[model samples]
Target: DASRIAIRHGLPNSAALPIAQHKDYDRMFADIRDKLHAKSGDPVKPEHLE
Candidate 1:
């Protein structure tokens, strides 16, 4: 998904995105993980997912 964002924004690669953008991507991933965890009723913490 980060790669897709990079490509969509014409970045050379995912690493080329700015730090803020990188964090945004990370947060997006975390949110998705949270949703999945919620559905499965897992007890894992968000920070552990990172």
Candidate 2:
């Protein structure tokens, strides 16, 4: 269930996806932040995944 958050942030099927047992929210968020930041400095929130 918690994994849904990661997937919504574009983490699913991604190499940066954290493991279930050892969740790394910081890394996951950082990856998302970097990706978004790299594309544009504007902070555009990711859409929720169904």
Best by TM-score: 1
TM-scores of the candidates in the order shown: 0.35, 0.31
Model 1 reaches what TM-score against the true structure? 0.35
lDDT tens digits, residue span 1-50, model 1 = 87778678876773564764777877886787777665344576767657
Residue pairs in steric clash, candidate 1? none
Model 1 regions more than 4 Å off? 1-21, 38-50
All models, RMSD in angstroms: 9.6, 10.8
| C-alpha lDDT of all candidate models, in order | 0.68, 0.60
lDDT of 1 at 19: 67
lDDT of 2 by residue, 1-50 (tens): 75678788877655554464355865786687785664435556655222
